[model samples]
Target: MPMRTRDSSGRRLATLAVCCAIVVLVLAAVAMPVAGHAYLSDSDPANGDRLEALPETVTLEFSGDGVQVADVTVTGPDGEDVSGDAVIDPDDDRLVSVSLERDDTDADGIYTVDWEILAEDGHTTAGSFFFSVGDEPVDRESVLEAYADDEDDVSIATTAAKGALLLAVVALVGVPVTAAVAVYPVVGRFGVAPSVVDRRLTRVLAGAGVVLFGAVLALGVARSASIGSSGLSLEAIRTFAATPLGHVWLVQLLVAALVATGLLAGVRGSLDRRYWLGSSLAGAVVVQATVSWTSHSATLVDRLQGVTVDFAHVAGAGLWLGGLCVLAAVLPTVLADAEAGDRDRLAADAIRRYSIVALTGVTLALLTGLILAVWHAPTLAHLAETTYGTALSAKVLLVVAALGLGGFTRFVLLRRLDPDRERSALERRVRGRGSSGRGSDGRVRENGGREAGDDPTVDETASTTSTLVTRVLSLEVALLVLVVVLSGLLTSTPTAVVAEQTDAGDPVTLEREYDDGIVELTVGSPSVWGEHGSAFVDEGEPVVFDVTFTSASDGDPLESDRPVTILAHNERADTQLQFDLEATEEPGTYSTVQTLPDPLWWELRVSGSPEGTYVSEWVDVYAVPDGHEHVHEYAPLEETGFTHLLRIGAIVVGITGSLAVAVETVRFGRRQR
Candidate 1:
């Protein structure tokens, strides 16, 4: 081995170590308690309360800390404002209040309260409720219909910006990882040094870095435009800059600069070759970590765990899918430029090395992906019901397609590229006859004016095999790019399980303890039912149950098990049913799907044996109307017209692109077969 090759190996190890250390730091530091959107926990003169006398002041308490009231209004039956300015409590930021300006002269039937709050993390939540003060009680449905802001449309430009940023990160990080772990080492063994590939690949790295920097800037502008009451104004930008989300953007900007500058310096030959590779890799990890912070993972209850899994997930994607992209871009060019004799060895070795790296990355991505899906959806109903679920489902389908393509590549295409097999066949054919050196056809043949041991037939076979592998890898790369974009959409969209309950209605919760006092169970019924006209579930529709088991002594979640047994009795129809619940990836959470065959009144009895002791828990009754379709309806806003088009367009494009990739993959498989 040459000294330069030894040095290159040492540098690769060092680069990998630096990346691992940076990942650890990210997992620790990003857990600094970034808050999620604030939700109303309780309010004075509570929602739909029929009060004989009006109160002096109305107060609201929220679920998240550091929440500040942005706007509040109280409307009387006569359609006039009758409330003072909203004020945040000094002792508890999550508490807000506004005094009523009503008088004896005022005649009231219904009073409506509407408010919007901004959480510390910069996202806003707004809602409406009603109270009655006269002989007529509050009509909840009427109030909601008149005052609720029904626009739930996500901004198209923002999601696009996010997708672009995600793609840029994958490209920027992926090239370096692929080169270090897969390309450089194998090529160097065949006498193609890292310095040699660096000279040829510098422009590609620089281009990826520049794209990433631009993407970071685009995300900031898009985010500002998408904010409420702050459409890209300087003040709006300043306000955003003061929040935790703004801080994440700032960090993204800095890291993007680091990555672009490092790669550019290497391209310009201004940085030391020994240090640039490691520095660029370390910068890539930081970029990926910052990108994870901008996702919905930051909104999870366990912010640290969510962020960590997200980081690992994207990093693995960068390694496998991103690396495939790098290979697709570089390998063909390298093969085209290499001497014919060297091409076979180079392609074979490079593919073999990258297969292992791709395998590692794919494994990490799939495992983390499963964890994230459970955290976001929790149940099949959630996966099928929400907008977030729709995007995730689409992404999962694409991933399955990619996995099929990858499986064929690894097991079939790659195996055919075995250089040793081709060489062995050539040798046997050339040396088949004992003294005469006749070919495999049993006839003496001339070398055809070609060099000894050079067979055109074997060379043609190697070239064809290499070409097939390249085409398949290219298709796989394209598929993964779509996956990354969908991942971006997922980050911007609300979680399937959490958001479904918020918009649909509050889920009913039941709690009970086991006889041994070692286990406690908390079960949350589905949000398919609501008071007034907002109800969702109909007869014979699937209902999901979210169950959690906790240790009685410590109040911590108990170990996961198959311990839940739910029995439902329809008192009106004299029908009863029993079923079991399955555990979810979330530590102590379990979920199951069942259907209520009849409408109107039903009672539930939940039981479990978590600690070798059976515990029966009492749950509340549920009501559903018969012969009604279970459908979710979103109220549209005037401003959401273009944004809605953009969102719909994105979905259409994703579906179309995925189908095209699948068709091409299938065609390619048929050709190989």
Candidate 2:
């Protein structure tokens, strides 16, 4: 009884470990995905808040990992970067702080901060926020508009290059390893061992691998060089050679060299199976580890776990899918000339042997894939709703379908093969269908369409099942290739967890560029932004009309403090409103307590020249009637509530798992006693 109890406990523990590892990884992945995307979390002055005056230091707090401090510019009302000597704190790089050296803080207008940051997840997030000193409340809608994507769209050529590089890396590592582990072993067992043809193929693939890696290396160096420079060139390699990413890229070059060496050894007939496996394994490790450092894994709060899972996932995918490439291409050729009996035996043996390795690889790849998916998307609905999620879902379906075919080949179809028999039933069936025992009758049919694996020549019989299996296998391989393509595309897509909500009402913002920076225009309604129009203010029944300007180029305020004038025209009612807006205490804001005579489509146009260039903006404000006096609620500028739910889920799962372990242990102890 005592021995039995220990064995039971051991089995249970093993089960628990596997289950817990997968569950815990997934929960931890989801736990902090909200912060995985580096975003501006907090600011010293706070967005839309009015400050008494500018402070000596301007600080921005970011939530997430891999926040690269590209630039932190604080534009005062004068449309210039007031943020002096931007620096990241050594202790906490997420905290970007800059000094405000000038007295421009006294100006009454919206003070803007423009930020450009690179998240380690290979994405760039650029945005601007406004805090007022003497001006009206910063119109967030206008600010968002001004800060919209005025920059060029993400480079299409760059994305294609990245995709090619990713494919090359996967094949570079996967092909040699798969060959050593699966292809060579199976083909060698069938007496079609590695030969000069194989060697030549390896040589070509190795050369292609080296060339591909070189392209990737060049791109990496080019990216490093182009970070703050004007363009990409050979000159950038000198600068790139010094950066951490550059160092990692160099390490990848070493790994690529190993891959080439391994392939070359096989090509030269000097390759031991162990040597090829070991070299490919080492190369895979370096490539996986190095890529993970700058990619999605770097953004995870649990860096170690994330990186480990990433390595496993990437390596597993390369092996499983890449191996299929070798199998699909080389399998037919190997079995083409074998006797009917030998062909059936050989095909079944090869597939069944490879199945075990494939199953393991597929399982790890899928589990890790699920873990990544859960991290990037808060819910199943999010996956269905988001493009990234949709792509992932398609990839998952493809994997499942391919795996199903693989299982069929390994189990039902292969198990039925009896190599000892004189002729396999599959070949027999094809022969039975014909007048004579052969693949072709040497006669044209009325339909002019060939039967399954049937030919016009009578000399040889065709096995329909073999052809069917081959076709199925080829389709499965094709789907897996698509899966890799989708994975590459995903590197550029935004996860559902980071997508912003659009329920909040705001105007389409616009931007005007200046020498130092760009200014943003956020449009707001009278109810949310206007002053109390009950007193001395004239024009219609005075509502508060405010114009908030924030600059992304520099944290300077509007250079001119002259009385701001804006003309409001209602084309429908044939009415116009003009306000000579006085400069509020805010540095770059012009405002007056005013309203339109009757609520209609009112166009408010303001023109100003802030240091760099002339700029004009027209904003439309719609005031609806229903016994007015309505105040709008500003959208929360922090993370969505969904992130907090994931946190709650993690806590719940952890507690449950712990309790389960405790309960199991206690039960076992009591039984022993």
Candidate 3:
């Protein structure tokens, strides 16, 4: 009776183990890839070059994703005012162009360009550069590009290191959880494989949390380097360290140490303390929360959604992988015993229970994954067209395949292998075979020996089958990791889109030489001509300009097509008025405006030409605060505050969420202990 009872328990436990293993394997195979692949590449102006004239647009290029141009600014020499317009390229969503007014280019000095680009992968890259105009010399020693280069290098290094660490942690933690679930018959009373798997997986998830914490620290260093700023002073460190992101690394380090210690102690048989388990579990949860901050989950609402999805993702992965470990190691051992019937029954029961749990985990994984996609992507087009989206699709497909396998194992195989009925039939077949060649007693002995002895063929077949299944599941998990790495890359801006949309077409120069004695003015308009006129302007209007002057050679009223007149309006008004002077008949410079209405208040006025008129000779004209007398130019492109905030917010949220998860995990462990 005692042996039978033990056999029954063993069989039930094996069944539970198989079921949990199936579910955990499926989840891991699906979720990890979806999380890793996000990043950025390429930018406009080609890094560094001297421009013949200022470019009206700035664009960026990416390998496989798309980007949103957040902002662009141009500051001229003397830090004075210049005519410039910033706007998105109508033809491409990724490009951002800025157009400067022709009149504002009078100052000959270096111009600084600063910009920000947001990638589809939910991260942002921002930096500044400078270029010389006219006769101004370029600064050869500037480290702006070096800083930008550092940003990319540091980000890649940090992400890779962190990702590797996370993978290791997940694997280590999952091992124990899998073992626990597999050995549940010996450990617990009920068929709660799903709950057990979940609990164990959660504890192991702390490994990933710790890895994420490391990533946050690496990112901060990268950010500081990119900015060309230094001073790891207490204040600087505190400023960064105090944030949810800064503390994530510190927390992860502590949690990792604790988890390692606990795991080692447990392995050595010295740590039977339940607190170790609790601490490990709590630490993992904290890590999950802290790492989430590095994602787009900084705000309360986003964080809540992120937390829910992340939990599902993490827990699902653990359960799937851990369950597989059990099915491979523990189930067969219990099945090959003398009281095979009872052992088989227990194993079958456990398998049945585990199937349900795995199904639930897979379901949660799918739902949460979809929610995350919807929240972050926001558009179907983005999902279909972006690199991030493509990786996500691949991950989804793998998950479906895993689910299908699980379904086959559950509904078809489990039902057919019904221990209550099948055991009897199998027993009859074996007994009959044995009886055909021997006496009843001899046949019974032969049957018992066959069941008890370890035959190479039977063992080989079972191991081969289990190994094949495990290999397939492991492949799925590996693909998931690739998907995650791609996701990280996708988060970076798409240089191609930005380049196409924001590149300034060609420069159109219109020059007019006026014989003004007092002012030898060679008025010129460097207009940006593109497929669309507004590509080079801020007010979403075409680039337009006007230049006018008066004659200083002769202090006499000049002739006009209709008449010649001078009305002195102010002391600063041009003393000599000339109109219709013998200037060459150019399309934009045919006629000139001369005259003033005196008390010396109103200056000479030229009407009728869209590009404005130029005086034939040099004449001093008074500068007016609100006057349009000299030359007026306009480039139409406008930037809104909302767009700026949106891009900035995305970057902040992503970085912050990643760090927060790390810190929370540490705090959780401390409290638990």
Candidate 4:
């Protein structure tokens, strides 16, 4: 009995260790930064600085990871905007140069310089600086421009750094959590010593946590460097350390230490319940806090939603991955033991238990994942067309593969090959045969020693089978880690700065008004130009209708009748308005209003023809806002059709399936003896 127990304990320990290792590796890989073009640093003129002469041009220096800018702009002191011919520096694609037209900037007033650069990450960052030409003095424009520049500078670095940090933490915590829940039942059914398994698992978790913490610190340093900070200062450190997020990181470090201590104690056969609980709670808290900071949990409603979903995601992941670890590590060791019968029973039980837990974990993960995806994405197009959407799709595919593997293990391998009652009967028969005076093929027992070449003992076969299962499960666990890491990356905003560069353009507006029973329209476009044509509204012809209404006792129009109209006109075409008008039936005073079909310049003719005629006003409808140059036309829903619905349905189904599997696994574990 003692020997059998020891073998079981060793197997359990091995299983937990493997599970923890897989989690660590997955999280680390997810945290690794993708190699791409990026802006390493930048130097622009300080805002509100006084210069003796107008510089020939504004120069912007940046490091690109893999992106290039097509143009840059400079708005002069006289409100004359100039765009320099943009070119990549000969030395590096990362560096770009723009040449502004040299104008006499000798006047002593403030000038605004704006730069638009494409980051290697495929996002665009734009900012402006203000400097005084000549030696006049500082003014309101200079101060406002200087302040704006400072705000932009701070925003860019802070947002990027925070985003990166959040991504890292999610990957690190998600993998192990997923694996533990998935394989929990298998680990439990193995009948391995819980103490040994817990000890090894704790050690793995602690060690990995510490390593990840160090990696995070290193990442912070790298981010700072990218932001052009040469050396860390007390203020900088304080800025990071004083925040709620900083406290979370500190807690993570502390939890890692506690986990290490707990593992050490368990290994020494001095495991304390308080220490174990404390470590687990602390570790969980750290993960939770990190999620709050990294996710959209800053707002009250979002916080509630995020916390719930994030917790579910983490817990489900841990249960699946952790259980897998225990199964993989211990199964081989148990199978190698001399007591082959016990090994067989243990392996069978473990597999059964793990299968159930894994199913449940998957189910929960799927459900919560769906909710999160919907909440974050909001629209079907975002899920299918955006970078985040594509990554999510990949994650779903991986999950499906994992689930299929799990199903095969449960239905074919466990249920068919290792039915509990069938295995018990076989064990009884083997024992009876060995106890009886039976030899190979029912012959006399001449030598008395079991024939070495004869049928192997039940225990031996069970151990071998267990070992094989462990190997297979280990592979599954590895794949799961990959999924978790990919998930972390997916949660981040995938639209990079470089991609935003192409989207920069001008603004256009469309406006129409009905006054004194006539429809009038106006269209305006910004002077700025881009590839897209400016927005222009055109109408067919003014359709006239009238509304009659009564005046109130207070002399105000009681029942005012108004019409909708659209007036359309382009720069090269004559403008016209199509109008729909309604008449009011109120007594004492009646009025009529009309609407134009298009937005453009139009004349409204209001007449009580040959009796009471009142002509009241011509209004210009502006199509575009001043200083903007372009507008995006909205595509009707018919254009996209049911593609969006299909995508959304798929996401929902995938998430639901994962949840169902996870729940079933947990119930199976609870029912197991």
Candidate 5:
């Protein structure tokens, strides 16, 4: 093929690849599983309630799976602990309760219920609320004044430890897999005895294993410190090892130790070299899988599917990023030692083989990354508004940059080392194209054999291509490392939905009588925007107004013939919105779903008709707290039948792509052997 034609063809191919990648990402965003740690959903003797009498127990409910009560304490007005140990409900894992202790003089002032919960996904969340036992309404500010709510401090050291652990995991998994799939096979095929290279690789693998082992240990210590303890103590480690997170930590420690031992055994020649290498590679994959289980994926209803996709995502990353580091570290030495006559041939063959592995890695990383992004962030609004979404966006951009660099290396730089084109260069020389006897790649050839430094132009061109490849590779590796660090942060960060839920404090209630001694209305304020209260509802999510009507004369429940409606007016924004209430199974009680438009104070009235038929006095309420501005007008697209199918299809594609790479690796290893 003509030089111009080949160049144009390569460009076209690169463009097509990028377009296909974009389409795949679009498809993967169709619908993702809502996977986040548990958040408080509802509570009995609810927050900010003024009770006629104290209930026997205070129960808390959550919206996530595998919830375990870490701590629950109820303090009386005198600041005395009045609750027994918190126990998970026998029927529902999401529910936990504590029995309250009452005296003859049951405190009439405010009582605070503080709680902490641990989800199986390795995260802890805690919150507090206040309720009173007398007729007087307690100001929220008073509750804050009387009892200082302790905020959980996020340890920076813990975050750093997590990042280090992730880096080590990627390196450990990548080194052996790259050696087996790319380096070993290609060099063997080139008739290059890789004994020296093998020794160096074994040392590298051993070092990675050591790092992995140490990282696992450091992560445990950091985890202990985050839980409010000096992690240096054995008791602290033992305490951490007793929780659900501790169980996973134990598995990680075991895997890291076993993999390190296997690699070391192979290095010392005490074990079957091939057997240990293969075992260690598989162990590395297990470590990667364990890491996924500790992420938000662990909270998914389809936990197995979520973890499988997550594992594939990181494994693919390890293959690509680790392989690049391996190539950059080892390939230079191999090339420098090659015979001058065979250097070009060996370089071409080895790089070409490694290119296939790299392509597979990129493909898996891109596809699975799309699945993971949607799973974690759901909507574009979430991506723009939430911390987790922002980090994910940054990672996606870095991946794209890495992809571009890889494509440039494969199509532009690697093409210069094509061995088959040596004959074509000689043919061109005979045809008098140029006396230089050079190929289109600017490499000199003597009767189908490369001759080093024969032409200054050829030498300079080769030098330039080599320099470009090295620069691109270095940048790509750096970007990928940053991507991994972000991934670690994401694994620890709460999803946007969870963050909103956590921010939403307890519900506030207001009651009023307004019908000339005929009827009464009580409203439990609903907020779609999360503030520092309970019952957090998200924008576009259903905001439930829990209300009841009672006959003032007899103190009996009153049922209205017509459904009740609430009209809310925000004086600040001059916005008026109305919603009709639906009757629940409870008599005289009605609930309605509405979404607040902004976080502003609003006056609400309950009525049965539109024209001044107000049954209750206008009551003041904050639909959403001040300063929490609206970020989006619409909610994320919920899963439809079609989107569900699309999600399933994406998962299948990810799994299939990963399996194809695994098969290729096995084939390469066998052939090289």
Candidate 6:
């Protein structure tokens, strides 16, 4: 093959390899969630069953085999967790019982329990039910739905507040922090001097620091409003300080204060050099910690591992993005300041240092991003199906675009602007600017100054490279900002479905005897039709319910004169979902496939006229919360220290990598010049 063709082949192979790697990551990530059929066979108080009082233990009986219960949260009349530690039946796992903690609530009004289960066969399912006390009629589905409503899921103010906080972090911390810790040091080694860097860099960092501190406060206030029962109120704000979210808020406030103090001390140029650097980096690491702890990682995946990977992701992004901002904002001014012999060397060092930051950033972002995606989205279909998955997909695409742009600049544009070419560009720029070249102190030199005798072409080359860097870095910053914004959305956006589609289990069997031992209902093993099944219904997806009614005396199928239909009532809205059933070839069996409209407890009312009297009987059905938003409502089970090690390792690796790049780039610049 020709040289050009061989190069083309190499590029093709590289691209193919990257594409293949992504496919593998996506495939491997499908975190097969624990799954199995776990439907309600019986409840202690019985759904919609009026009771004079409630039992101490809320017992849930499931007919399915090997059912393990989780997320068994109970809300009483006052909307507090009444369900305490839930335990599965020791002998028969099908019976899950939760002890009630009713210090604040008696057997009054309505009590709702939202529970999920994992089966021995590897299928996970979830549902909710409502129980009434003291003769108050519980509109089964309505009361349960209303009891579990999430105000934050649809709140625009919440989304906007989170987005603002994210943008503020990137601007105030990402850019300025990276500049102070990563960018300025490299330029200073070309004799830019610590004093000069402090003078020029402190103003930006100070302004950004103040903005970040303010943003942290604003984020806290917004969080209180979003998580409160009422939207944007003083009481909500006050109560927020007591929640787990409030705990995160307090941590963030401390980190913000530390960052502000470090920026102030660094800009003063009065602190010990090591102390200044150590304090600033420490503050930055804490910022990443606060972010990781409050982020989706803390709730969505394995807590410690998620936090560690996310910390690396945030740290890398902060440095890389921060460096880009510094370049874009400071480079144009730096290029116009002086036409010196070492100007090209200075530009080269800065570019190489930033390249290293970008390399680390891209690597961290891609690696952590894959883990998060796979944890939340176990399959490709989830990318489109879940809101969180979709937002993350968008972020990944944007990051990739930015990475490609950076690659082009580093490998193509930066390579083209070698020492000779960059010097010529800088020399020409000095002539075109129309001002007498300035001295290193930024004061204008006379027309006959020392720089006036130098080759104009040398100045033009470096100046051209600076301008190119500015333009490319500007675009890169824009993309990075968008990724940050999408990240905010991903954190706030609710998952569309709570149940994981990991294990498609065998059919579920249900039998209910109603109507004075006259009518018997049998829901046979559910079979999946389309995207939904009787075992677990996906929203707006159809499920084929294989239902049959038989006479209690003979244990035979019952024939109805009036048309038989299934009514899935929306309890909140006082509406009903009707699915007309047709008689099957088998005597008493009837089948119908209908779409489940929304995620809520549906009153499954089967009505018909069998022989003489009109017959109507109902059972409660819950298809899980559409999104797994409830997982973070309370603190998760405490994790082991093993997870914390992951985060510590990432923090160490990031700082070490940054220091290595700064040292290497400074040395290389000195050598090359």
Q: What is candidate 1's lDDT per residue for 83-186, written digit by digit as tens?
A: 99888787877788999997845646788787776554434567776677867733323333422332333567767877887787777667777777567766
Clashes of each: 0, 38, 88, 117, 5, 32
Clashing pairs in 1: none
Superposed model 1: Cα runs more than 4 Å off? 1-38, 52-57, 63-70, 76-109, 117-124, 134-141, 146-153, 190-196, 272-276, 427-452, 503-673
What is the clash count of model 5?
Answer: 5
lDDT of each: 0.63, 0.57, 0.41, 0.44, 0.64, 0.56
Top candidate when judged by TM-score against the true structure: 5
Candidate with better lDDT, 2 vs 3: 2
TM-score computed on alpha carbons, candidate 6? 0.57
Candidates ranked by lDDT = 5, 1, 2, 6, 4, 3
State the lDDT at 137 in candidate 1. 38
After superposition, which runs of candidate 2 have C-alpha atoms over 4 Å from their true positions?
1-35, 101-109, 135-158, 200-208, 218-222, 225-243, 261-277, 336-341, 411-468, 501-673
Per residue, candidate 2 scores C-alpha lDDT tens digits across 1-673 of 2446543643454355345446545545444443244566557765454667777887877656555435677787768667787676778867878788667535667677777664555455666666667646554344444324312113444455556656666665566655654455556555665662275446645664665566566556535533443456665565455545567667877777767677677666698556654665566567767777766645554667677666667766765676666667666766774555456666665565445345445645665665565567657666688767788888878888988887787666664443323234434555565643333664223233544233322213224456656777788778887887777667666555545321122233434454555555443321223223211111232244555555665566765444457787878888886777666677776655454665645676776666545666665556554344222111122334654564555445445434444454454345335
Q: Compose the digit string of candidate 4's lDDT tens values, residues 4-97.
A: 4534433443344334333322332212112112322333443334568766656555432322443456666567765567666756665655
CA lDDT for candidate 1: 0.63
Q: Any runs in candidate 5 off by more than 4 Å, and if so which?
A: 1-32, 89-91, 142-154, 228-233, 265-272, 422-468, 500-637, 640-673
Q: Candidate 6 regions off by >4 Å? A: 1-53, 56-129, 132-154, 164-196, 226-235, 261-278, 340-342, 421-461, 495-673
Model 5: per-residue Cα lDDT over 184-256, one tens digit each? 6556655667775666677777787887888788877766544422335776677678877788889989988
TM-score of each: 0.66, 0.63, 0.48, 0.52, 0.70, 0.57
Please give the TM-score that candidate 5 achieves against the real structure. Answer: 0.70
Better of 1 and 2 by TM-score: 1
Deviation in angstroms for 98 in model 5? 2.6
